[model samples]
Target: MRCWCGKGNDTSVKTVGVCVRKDRVSPASSTGVLLNNAGFDYNVTRDRQSAIIMFCHQLNLSVMINANNPDDVLSGQNVTLDSRDIYLFSPYLVTNGRFSSLTDWQQKAVKCFNKTIELGIKVACQATSNSTIAATFNMTDLFSQAWYGTAMYNFDYFQATDIDLSGMTNVVYYFPNLNMNYGTTWQTPNVQTNALSTHYYRQTDTNTLHVFGDGLAYGNGTLTQP
Candidate 1:
């Protein structure tokens, strides 16, 4: 008098040829086991199962128990989540995570990328400027190359004096218009025959003049033609 319990058998109605087992079935071995029984080949690891479940729950995705290859559908979703994590944690990605819209994220990404590129270029230029080839060029040329074709001049008097412009051709001087209330006397060279005297004078004021040996004067006062 052996009996069988068919899947479609109703417990309330006793059938002639079918019987029901009264003992309870144990729980599934693991999450993997449950997923496997539901026709998915998910890896039988606790962490992997937990990660997949949590990720799906966060995105409001349904974990269909009876679907074929349920884990395969999550492959792209997992990749997307990984990409987002990379962008969020990257050192170069500057963001407040408060995107008003999708276009806002796009604009921020472009700006960050441009800034990163500019920084890289500046670093590279600085390194190149320290090389031997840069030594052959003047400070102005090196500065122009490093700063993307912008010329930089030293405005300090000492720094300007340190630069040797003797080899440079076509030197020009600019002087501002000045008004002198009194006229000054020029020193006459000695009338020695066959002897040359080179004297340079810088006029500091309308009443005083300092003379040097062959150096141009920079002053703000008027000078009479020699």
Candidate 2:
């Protein structure tokens, strides 16, 4: 017998069927197999792997390295004894030839799709900024574009690793009133000249953080002065 996925039976497992539990679809839905392991927990496969990997990635946020690599894992090379990484990764391993969940494949798909879209947007934004540059300045497109906007003064600083902002712009001008962590204590840096306007900023907002640049946001298409 064939499955709804249109694939012939496994021929090896006589009782297996297709699963359609509102999860685990495929790029080409027509060719995707929805195997039913009957009494399996899908989370044991997909969610646990992604969550653990993400947790490890987060714990090593300061190190700028991936901990799951076997070289870093098995050989003990490039491995830091980050207990957080160990605690996060160890529990997901298969025990006694069994796992607790099988829904991992769906979460894996979600992660892959999300990362692709995130990277594509960053590349597009950087490219758009580059195409607008005058070429003679020998400066980066991100820096030049910000200067031409209503930044007014050097209200920000951008290193490959961090960014510091000064002055007031609408996006952050309301920071002090937001009732958030930095609410009452927020203050714009006192910048001296307009020279700082030449720096490019990648600031994070409530939705996304520019992990590539100090977890800041890349302001929505450049906030302008009214």
Candidate 3:
């Protein structure tokens, strides 16, 4: 049977309510028993001292117990213990889960972002008007630039003309409707099919006319007023 200290064998015994010592046992043997019984299977090496310290700390062992014996405690080494090592050496410290490194955390974040993007696309497809698109945008507002940019680009295809450019002073044409084809050459109002489209007539600091289509376009006096 396993002892209370978590050691595999029953040869070692605990005394005085502390597992630090056994009946007439050497300090090294006692320390080994304490570590093994406590479920630590790592070797006591100079490089693993900090891990040992973390393990002991998790068990709430007295610091004096660490300092009393020099042979059991390896020295002359510096090593930083990360979450992975902490979990590996002493799993009781990690209640949530374990991440091996920063890369692991980043991968998890990417996975979550992908799921959010998938949901946002579904929301965008069902959006019928400016208000619905705005509401859908709010849902993906916290996503990264890449995800939101793609969402905005795809959303333009569905309701490009419904976008509200009320506060935009530089915007000359918010396009009365989404009839303009993507990547097609800009046409003059006289030759264009959609001539009745309400074109915004405004004078700005520059002659630049902003057209919001599949992608933004800029030109000087190309879009004329009816």
lDDT of each: 0.23, 0.22, 0.25
On a 0 to 1 TM-score scale, where does candidate 2 land against the true structure? 0.15
Which tens-of-lDDT digit does each residue in 1-226 have in candidate 3? 0123322333212222243332334444333222332222423343334444354344443221121122233223443222121111111101111112222222332332343344231111111123223323322211112122222222222122112322333332232322232323223221111132212122223321222111112111122232
- Candidate 2 residue-wise lDDT, 1-226, digit = tens: 1122122323221122122221343334432221222111222232223322333243232111112221222122222323222211111112111221212311222332233333221000101221122323214323322222212121122111001111122122111111122122212322111232222222222211111111132221132211
RMSD, every candidate, angstroms: 33.7, 21.3, 25.2
Stretches > 4 Å off in candidate 3: 1-43, 63-74, 79-226
Worst 10 residues of 1 by lDDT: 150-159
Off by over 4 Å in 1: 1-124, 127-142, 149-226
Evaluate model 1: give its lDDT: 0.23
- Give Cα distance to truth, residue 135, candidate 2, Å: 14
What is the C-alpha lDDT profile of model 1 across 1-226, one tens digit per residue? 1222222212232231122112221223211111222112432233333344344334433232221232332232232221111111011111111112222222333332333333221101111211122232323322222121100110011101112221233332221212234234423321111122222222222432221121122111122333
Better of 2 and 3 by lDDT: 3
Order the candidates by lDDT, highest first: 3, 1, 2
